[model samples]
Target: MNYKRLLFCLFTGFTVATSPAFAFQELQPSDDYIQVSKEIVEILEGTHYNKPSINDQISELAFEDYLDALDPTKSFFLQNDINALSVYKKRFDDAIKSGDTQVAYTIYNLYLKRVEERLTDLENNLSAMLEGFDYTLDESLDLDSEHYTWAKNKQEQDETWRKRLKNRALTLKLNGETPEAISEVLTSRFKNQLKRIHQTDAVDVYQIFVNSITAALDPHSSYFAPRASETFNINMSLSLEGIGAVLQMEDDYTKVVRLIPGGPASAKGELSPNDKIVGVAQEGKEMINVVGMRLDDVVDMIRGERGTTVTLEIIPSKGTGQTSKRIKIVREKVKLEDQSAKKEIVEVTRGDDTYKVGVIELPTFYSDFAAQQAGDKNYKSSTKDTKKLIEELRKEGIVALILDLRNNGGGSLQEANSLTGLFIPSGPTVQIQDQNGRITPLGDRDPKIAYSGPLAVLTNRMSASASEIVAGALQDYGRALILGGQTFGKGTVQALQEVDKGQLKITQAKFYRVSGETTQHKGVVPDIIFPSVFDTEKVGESSLDRPLPWDKIHETRYPIYWDMPSLFPILEPRHQARMAKDPDFIALNDQIAEFRENEDKYKTLSLNENTRIQINEETEKRELDRENARRAALGLEAIESVDDIEPTDKLVYSKEAAEILLDFIAINQLAEREKAQQEQAN
Candidate 1:
């Protein structure tokens, strides 16, 4: 994660290198780096959950990871360059263990040389290349790097780059830029990229090399340089500042990975995971193109004092980067009250009976650690607030309850256990298995049930970590019906250790459900799946690289509250029928399908100007058509294209969950009445 965008809260918040060979001084590993490298190896091998060995296999994987990190698009290095670097391919393990970073440094220095060469080539021929493109030609460019191999030679690389440059022009032209503006933007970006490359320091190179080795073992483990370590500490302590987003460098773009629950972006609900930020502007300033910019530099530009606004030119996660939208967020402290549990009452009428359904939206499982340690009895915590909210909901005459954990990317494990206890009797809520293969069950020791009425838990692909623990626990105990999309599978525990100069966040343990199923790669699956806009392939823990594998251990002892399976038959059919015909749901499904089709088509983009124009127009038309269709179905007035669409306050998923909870209540009522009749007859 980029330190600049590390936290929407107070704290949260990548780079490159090279050489006198390209009029830039090459970075050499300092004495600190050598000692730190050895320390990292010792810690990872001695205490990491996987107990990874520093062997040839790990070295080979690190080599690939390092290369990909440097040039993910494979545009900078040639096949021959890679061939030359292969000698160090299997030497990284020994290098790290022996405190020798020459292998990593050599590879990075060469990569920097290639970057300088490519940018220089672009700079030298920009005018001729810009004038030379024939948009009428039926050519296409493959954007997926995995589909490409290293260019055989400079000519092959030039041809690939020529098409790329043309595509860049075409993209900007389609976005309404003039020929002069496009030329200026392209020239400035190329120059800026080269300038930033020259600015790369030893810390940048060291962080990349160490991370490559750590990430080779598992996606969750990583090394943070001194600067990044400071940002990480701030994130753990502060909850106010910036826009509350975690950003990473993907190719040339800074991508939003996660939006902090209480941050402005999450609250605003416009910025989403996987959205690529292409440009940024301060309030009342011109938008600065950020393509090929360093992650920290971009962050520096985006961060501001509280109450100030920063606008981002975002290529939406759902779009194929051809179209973009701007979002403006006010920088502010992410207050605990803002993230606190909130309750709502939804009234659902079936035939004649009106049922009041309680809805609690928990953004994150948070606790005030400072206050708690200070013996503050009323210290802010998710469980305590939720318990109070439930009491308030019960007072409002609600008969059923729904806990909405949508987009809750887990927080404190203690909160997860205590929160789960609010609905079930004392029992193990989650199990942790460490490197020693010993299982430790962490559960709610309290015997009190906060709200035991007909219950349903709503989750989505972004519901992760602590969220998964709570959802999985309730589901295993048959205490609630899990609804919505599959939860984010992030059940691994990470602990930060201070190395010689920086910090290392390493995976230390794994989380399992009371049912013995590990929630690492395969998050908690909902009992009633809902139509989701999130693409499984693009979101969730399973989508990450080298995620810990899913396995099971012995099940923990816990009493079931209900025979949930028996009720699924009645609920599943009703849900399917309702969602299939529901106007909002139908529209959602159509939009997702359209987005997916665009994704497939965007794998390789047409170079023909007319074809691209036609495609963009058709996409907008389809989007407008779907919007009008949905409006007409709901008997609302329809307006013009794209511009006419407005954000609605309606909670579509929550409404559906209310309907499901109503059905659950009805089922239980019928069972009770039948039992009474039988008893009377007997």
Candidate 2:
């Protein structure tokens, strides 16, 4: 049941020794790292599906990716530094082949020098400007500088830092912070950032360089340092006693990328993917701002013994302005019991006839393979738990079902196959194409139908891997109505290889649906698409560089239980009409539109306090109006303002999904009746 095709959980650790400021020195790569680099190159060249050559072209790509990894925003490094390092752009492959990392080390040393220069400038400039900084200047700071040109000189870099600091101060000012408090926070954040940069050891730089090379091959392939590999194992096993959240460094912010089901954070349901963690506080302690802090250091701050409370200052992924909130969560082990399949029945009334639909919300396609292998009869698995839940729901007289796969990032490939088997007569479910041009068809050998009633699979952008397999299979067989947004297009298979004290996750295969379409870049498209706040331009596999392109092979024949294509014309108009009148869906679409507008407008922030405040007020008003409208539609009291609204953990999309399922049930039943009558006439 190994779901090797899913996203690989990997991380790397580094030494964090205290160092004196401005103590710039050369960092030498360990002999082991050099050897591992060679091994990694050999393995990737031999085993990777892309079969990329380590020529000047790849060397150039690796060099650019490496630079981007080091300074994504192009904030620290100057144009001179980039020009100086351009000589090594075509020499990385040569350096790798010779097992001599002098070029990489030299480039990293230069980056360190730039960082030291910037830190010194920030300390001096901010300390002098804090006394009489102008807050009413008509200026704007471009937050997204990914494509911005590097600073031409030290003077230009200083101006960049000035604007950045001004924006920081303006944000705090807008949040009702005093000038003195804002100054203190900015100083501390800058100092901590300097310390983190100083703590970057040789191993950290080596890992980044190696990852850059692998990333140039394919986005999925990566190199994990020894400590990172250990962390990866802990995350995969979900055995770590912490908040049960996966964190990554996005610019200087530690972003929450995934929330493990049954974990403290997931149970709270307030924290979401893409939310930035700015501060972390232990119980009864002052909050420490984590902005510009090392990601591993932030993780250490958040992880502690079970039952101990950790408070996080989170900047939500949605909305506009510098809005933030504090969430207190008690750390605990993520229980598998919480992740197991859960069932509920949504009662839908149409014309005085109530249709009860069973909803099986799957958090992950999990399987306790270790327990099963150890002969534990009660080994929990997604397919097994779902089958039991279906049986229970059947006994309750449920007429239809919704397999909720929203936010399910997939696990256990065998479970996906078996889960698909529950609805369709057994056949090939997914096809895997390896580096050697061999296609292997994996299927459910058993022909048992677990549930044959009207079915719909609900998914979102976060739904991926094994979830995609099940959804795609059902869609291919016309067995279930696919609902929600396009899934996370992660169709590549990775195999973990142990090297000298490290691990390399190389993309070795690609997954294709039974109908021959690969889900690499374009994920499974639902029959009825929903409006999502997730920006696909920034979120999916297609958004990433060097991703494998979508293609198709010969289709694996499978029986079509329901002709969804023929039914789409009859069903889509009805579904659209219902959504047009659905208050929740209408609110969702409005929210999405507002979110997109805010995102577009806030890419660059105005430094003028009046303009910034005006923008913030407008955003707040819009959000408040949207919330009140939704409340009114749901038969709840409307709030006066956004501040009056209480935060709740309810997922709005999930409720909308239940309504869609109701429509699906009605349409399916009517279609069945029509088919029967036509058969009688025939």
Candidate 3:
């Protein structure tokens, strides 16, 4: 239910079925895979949070999901293939339970055949199409084929392939590649795709089949192949020496989903979320086009020894065009120095008085578990680092503090509890509900309060899991003002169990805040909400299908440190007035509105070359105008063109949140002075 878990699901490689046996030889599922399938089913039915019955309905859904997994774009398999595989739709549950995976293997074999046939067709047709393709034609292709039925026959499949190939060629042409270059690239990309397809073995198919079953139970529940399990561990540990960006496969493209806060990519500030990596090259090596490479293979290519350089060709997520840029980065370990909690001081001028507010940016709730096990007294952790930062800030004469947890996809539940202990006296931080409906409270064991000053917690849509736990606990205790958009709402707990040669990541429990609110589908709502570009319907847990619902439990008794709810009414109007006059805030709102509008307009693209070019130009111009407007409002010079604007020039909503923290500091100071005056009178 966390971002890493989602990435694991996307990045885990799976194979699809091809046609009947003539095109390519069929590989049958091994006895080992069959045995593992049986074990997986037993575990899911017995211990999974849902405890779902493997009935006919579930089997039928799994069957359909398996088909979709194989031919998601409906590019390879024909209607005849679907018909041939339909016989197993109602019998998958029985087969899985009995350790009879013949049907699954049969489907996989068919898929392999279809892929072989498609590759042959593509190779045969590429030369002629590349030689005589007309770019100026007023033609378009519906790239989103989810609603379309499977191709009725081979002729229909051929037509679909032709359109798809033409679209690919047009995309390259739009990017200014020469015809000869386009031909070579397309030929190589297709050949590599075929080679990867051939590399899919029986274990890969077994993982895919079992995942289809687990995915039916819930989106978070999955079966990771042995190698995939290793990938999952690396993702969770964040100790690997690499670029420090989370990669996932989307529509055959490896995408940069997130950049770890202190990683090389984040430090360089060149890579961004949703940017597609089409090609990767080693230091002083020829670039390899990774368009259709397996996620594991691509990861291997990106990862290397520390202090090594890797270059990436990135297709920007913006607009409907295929423009790309290259970025080179030196790999480094995601060390404590990069991921550990960091501190800064911001001086705010209110009328004549200057107030210093300390800001602590927590990238993750991380801890050196190995170091602790090794009995190192200096083991690094979020709580320890945060405590030290607070002490340093206190010595520097700070009035208030802000715990910035933006984009922190959480880690270590123990760290979340200990981090909450840093602010408040002993109390329950979060509660866990297991599969049998047993609720267990996880409280802050440490009685020491690290800092008791006025506090605010900053969050965004990406603030998830342990981040939600910490923010929700602090808010529930009335110890800190929660500021920003709602958190990511990932409340479920997953446990990885080794089954035979693979791992089963099953959802075993759910998380609840001390105040009895579940941070599942509905994440923690900030006391003071800020403007965000993320669409809740598209980005949060609520957007996911079959997510655990939001619920409540009995509230725990904890003493409130401050009456924040009572103070919000007085602060809301003042904050609104400030935002209305602030140029940066105004620009942020305008940009958010424009973003929403563009999202709606570009849901389906005009594939015609001229129309696509025009749309891209318009989008670029609009973005440029918005950036210039923001710069002018901030008393900075406006750039004449979009190309002149650097990546760091992009507007950040956190600056507005920081300003709010300053307001909070000033108001709290005024209240404390008034209280002192009253005490003197008494």
Most accurate candidate by TM-score:
1
How high is the CA lDDT of each candidate model?
A: 0.86, 0.82, 0.80
Q: Candidate 2, residues 127-218: lDDT per residue as tens digits? A: 67666568777988887755477899978877877887887777777777888888788878878877888788888888888887887888
Root-mean-square deviation of Cα positions for candidate 1 versus the true structure, in angstroms: 6.2
Model 2 lowest lDDT segment of ten: 5-14
564-592: candidate 3 lDDT, tens digit per residue = 87778877887788778877677677767
Clashes of 2: 1
All candidates: TM-score = 0.95, 0.93, 0.91
Q: Which whole-number lDDT from 0 to 100 does residue 151 have in model 3?
A: 90
From the highest lDDT down, the ranking of the candidates is 1, 2, 3
C-alpha displacement of 482 in model 1, angstroms?
0.2
Q: Which candidate is the best by lDDT?
A: 1
What is the C-alpha local distance difference test score of candidate 2? 0.82
Residues 1-682, candidate 1: write the lDDT tens digits: 2222222112210122222346766667778777888889999999899998989999999999999888888889999778767767888999889887766766776688789888987998999999999999999998775688899999999999999899989988887899999899899888888999899998898899888899798998999899888777777765448898888888878999888878888878789898999888998986778987888888778777889999998988776655678889999877887889999998888888788899999999999998999999999999999999999999999988999998899888989999999999888999999999989999888999898898999999999999999999999999999999998899899998998898999999999999999988889999999878788877888888899999999999999989998999999999989989888888888887777767767778888999988877887898789889989999999978786776442378888999988888889999999999999999
Which of 1 and 2 is the better model by TM-score?
1
Residue 493 error for model 1, in Å?
Answer: 0.5
